[model samples]
Target: MTAKIIDKHCAQDGDLRPQHLPQNSKTRQLNLFEKALVPQNGLFIFSAILLVVYAIAPAAVYLIAPVGESFLLLSLITICAVTSMLLGSQISLFDSRFKPSAPRLAIDRRVFIAVTWLIFIAFVLITFSTAPSIPIWTALRGGATSNELSQERGEFLKGREGAGIALLYISTFLVNTIVPYSIVLLYRVKSSLRHWAAAVFFLFCISFMQKALFLNLILPLLVFLAITRKLSTKIFLPVIFGTVGLLLLTTALSLAGEGGDTSNTRSSDYLTALYAPSNPIDYFIWRAAAVPIFTATDTLVVHSEQFGSRPLMGATSTLISSILGIERINLERFVFEHQFGGWNDTANSNAVFCIDAYVNFGWPGVVIFGLIIGLTFRWFKISTDIGFQSLWLIFAFVLFSAPLIGMLLSNGFAYMLLHGLYIRVDRHGT
Candidate 1:
């Protein structure tokens, strides 16, 4: 009877797989292709997104060479990197060939509350130090949207580059570590703690003045709750729709406010044409699914044209340099110098993990990092039960858009992963 409940709860929902029951003695390990069939595993999600955003779309745009004509050289490498990831998924080191065991934790109420308050206070300090004006609060009270403040936001970030402690808190602590692990704590802790956690979470998000804060923070909660049958369908459906509606409203407002500024049109003919949306539905399809593939691709394109056969030799990453006690080189600024004549927050394009790997190790770097990504996601799946497993999407999102080293060390997902591996989920998957 309990098994039936878990099975029904975990059953097929769109691309996600039903949860695997706890394995008995005779069960066998799943193979590579079999793993791809399990979108619930997260390997599938990460690889599929990378294939499209990093490989396919970039390859298509490269055919046109919208921004940099020379980016075409790296197309084959992108394909190889993605392919290596698939192959890497099959080679399991700490491979859980059997179904994961049940996981549970007992957190003291006092400890949980104390940690939540600590994180909340840290978030408040971050907001005041970095953004004194609190743009999102103003927008809530009938002020200009965050979209209108893009230039000002960029200038604020540029101005703070010299402040070491403030920069670390904003760029490393809040983004990469605290909030994410805190989400894990929310999942595992007792219900009495949730109300306080949620309250703290809301203030922290809005304090940051981001419109997408709700989606990033709450969507994972909903996904996990629905999978565990902790939230009822009626409530889940309504909340999901409302969250999406809010996002759409903010995006539409941005589009409406930014008229007459063909600066968007002039910025990159590549993204403008590649994701050329005639309406909101089309615009959203690109925004939610696809990313700015051209930024990293163009960086590589520019790198190839300028440096040619020379890799950065591990200069692009501060994380790498710090551990090795070497000088850090800023590749984004270097790339920007060639394109826009200077490197600032506005000019520096984000180098996602795979591209950063390529920048550091050239062709071989992609394969090594691809294997690491595949292994990492696989670890996230088998090492934990469904609740922690749900965080796969969040980690995958970080990889899809940001650097890997930052996620592992600076952001604290590595420790979070450790926590999941040790604590795990319930055997019945509730």
Candidate 2:
């Protein structure tokens, strides 16, 4: 008999699914990395999704954003970085050095439950402090302006800057990654506590006031469920409807500008720079797709010219910034400042980590580190018995803001990932 993966959440479903051999099978058995990297593997599929966002999406920079003096150089650097990442991922598949045959630790059921409760309680307390009150709750009742609600819902501690921004990242992980992840884990085991987990998640979403929060919950959870369960294709209709509702919800949040005027288009640096048409659909297209590339490219062009061959090293990192007695604002804030030229505390030109990677170490750093990052993800993935881990979804988005190093060092993702490692979950409703 073939040995199945021994895992924490290694449910019967993961074991039930028949593992198909590669089409070009030979006498030699495929290694764990080879199996994990295959298209049919959920982890591989998740990695592909990340590749599109991190590696492929930057190409939009050339077509969308106007060229700057350093644009050509930055593009070349970006291209090289992407190439390095691609090569690195292939290398991980071909020659992964790790050999995790089983979970390194096993947690008791009672201890796990107690810890889960503690996490939920901490989430509620932290979310309450950050949001204070749900912005949308007041907005829905016409107690506040749409614009004010929109800003508050999006900002989460606009009062703080520099190293205080680390608090914002922590709160974000608690809301975006931790609480929901807890809910998913509890649900997978058919626990009644999942109800409480959902309540905390919704409360956080209401307080935070972004349509994307719900989509974050829905999309990844849906993908996870689809990967583990034999869901019918018909399941997508509700998701489509839910997504359309979310799109409309996003447009609605920004419908009114200042002075209670619903018709006026909101003044946004991105909307103005990208020259998107004054409509809802186009607004989303530009916001979600084009704007990230635009900001990333602008960062590359401006940063290269500003610093020349020298890199910031780790000045961009919050932990390093705190230690070095430097201001801890994200690198995106600097790019936004160069473009808009204000206090610039309220906005940023956020991009995937590679932009900062390039700024910090130039093309060579991006290449060498990109390979290392790919291997870490593959190894983390191969450790789990089940292919679809919820952390994969959260970590993908986290990488958009920071890289593996940044996530582990500063963003609090490391804590959240480590939190789940040994909490043994069961298929028979444990």
Cα-based TM-score, every candidate? 0.72, 0.73
Give the top-scoring candidate (lDDT).
1
As a whole number from 0 to 100, the lDDT of residue 388 in candidate 1 is 48
Spell out the clash pairs found in candidate 2.
none
Q: What is the lDDT of residue 422 in candidate 2?
A: 36
lDDT for each residue of candidate 1 in 156-207, tens digit (9 for 90 to 100): 3333565534554454455434454455444443334555556566555544
The 0-to-1 C-alpha lDDT of every candidate, in the order given, reads 0.56, 0.53
Best by TM-score: 2
Per-residue lDDT of model 2, residues 1-430, tens digit only? 0001111222423232224212233233434433433323533554455456544544444456564434345455555655665566556452222233334354444465567668657755765665545666655555465547655654665545566555566655555555555555555554656555565565555455565665445544544444343223344455567667666665555543424323544434342343533556666776776566566666765666666646777667767778878765476777777665653555666666666777777676788766765654554454442322545555656666555557665545566545434333444324
- Name the regions of candidate 1 deviating beyond 4 angstroms: 1-39, 62-74, 96-113, 138-148, 151-181, 184-190, 229-240, 252-257, 263-291, 323-327, 334-342, 345-347, 385-387, 422-430
**What is the Cα-based lDDT of residue 313 in candidate 1?**
65
